[model samples]
Target: MKKKFLVMSDSHGQNDLVQEVIDKESPIDGLIHCGDMEEAFGKDLSFPMYFVKGNCDSRRIGKKIPYERIIDVCGYKILICHGHLYHVKYSLQDLINEGISQQVDIICFGHTHIPLITKKKGILLLNPGSLAFPERGYQNSYIVLTFSENGIHYSLKEVMEY
Candidate 1:
């Protein structure tokens, strides 16, 4: 069996880009919005979605919204966060430490506006970057993670057609 998920982050205030990605990558098992969404776009999605509150998300959005989430898919544990709390701009050590403590298999976050995928201390760390406001020279993109009996695989997909 193969389970696939679409992962994104740092939309900031642009829900249009979010829609674009969803339209392009439908039929997925689930969608993971790392953080920094503007509105209630999750309601419009066709598939199940996991969302976290980013630094920019105001309390007005909801008192129940959480800053982090843990999801299990195909026996893989995934941690989703916005990265501001972990100081991702400077280093991934904070995030890595959290994953270690939590005993998660994957850590996904955004905030540096840079796309990254790496394995640290046997844990997979992913930053899908910003679909709306990518860093200079970086393409607007997201990630997809596929889990199978064999193992897990990932890919970085550019959202910008150009």
Candidate 2:
């Protein structure tokens, strides 16, 4: 089976773009929000969403999001988190080490509002960036990931409209 996932985070209540992205790109099997959504996932959400609380989040949704979870996505083990807890930008080495310890195939996190799709020590580490305030020099963006038995496939989509 193929597992398609919509990965995002840090909306801070601005959901128009996010909602548009999901609606236009339907049939997503899972949604991962790396926190700071202001708890939008609990409301107006109709997908299987897994979220984590960011520093800006008024509600600690990550607690309910089942932290440190190992999800099986088409035989791939995915580890998801908000990234702030792992000190994302400053140091991803710790996060990578932890992922290795947990034996996960992919690790996802968001905090610096910078999207990334890179590998460290053979493990995939990704950050979908901040959707609401992406004006921090880079285009507002998100990611779509297709996990397969062979590997994970993905693409980046930019939010061109306000």
Candidate 3:
């Protein structure tokens, strides 16, 4: 069996982008939202999504779907969170350290609206950033992770507006 994930974060209110990405991408097994997806958008998302609570997430949204501290994504045990709760950006090292302590194979987060994929102490850290408004000033994109029996590969796909 093969495993593939569609990852996005910080929609801020852009639900159409989510739909656009899903429609355009090939096959994907799951979805991960690093959060700040406004309530209006999150509710109507058509795929299975695991999300963390961003600082901007309202109490209502949090109450409806509490962010999971850890998850088993594909064959990998992952720590998933919005970086604000973990103090990212200024301290990615610290966040990675904590993920190591938690014995997670992958650490996924979003908050800085910048994409990053790096390894530290055997842990893979990934930030898909904002799929709606990328701070990088390029087009909005999402990271797709594909897992096979041999290994894992990732590709970033930008959404095209119709």
For lDDT, the strongest prediction is: 1
Candidate 2 off by > 4 Å: 42-46, 58-63, 66-68
Write model 1 residue lDDT over 15-132, tens digit each, in one string. Answer: 8787888778776888888888856674555567898988888653565778999988888888999999999999999999999999999998998889999999999999998888
- Ranking the candidates on TM-score from highest down gives 1, 2, 3
Model 3 residue 82 distance off true place after TM-score fit, in angstroms: 0.9
lDDT tens readout by residue for model 3, 20-62: 8777774667788887886645444444678777888866365
TM-scores of the candidates are: 0.94, 0.88, 0.88
What are the Cα lDDT values of the candidates? 0.86, 0.78, 0.78
lDDT score of model 3? Answer: 0.78
Q: Model 3, stretches more than 4 Å misplaced?
A: 40-47
lDDT for 145 (candidate 2): 92
Model 3 TM-score, 2 decimals? 0.88
Cα lDDT for residue 158, candidate 3: 71
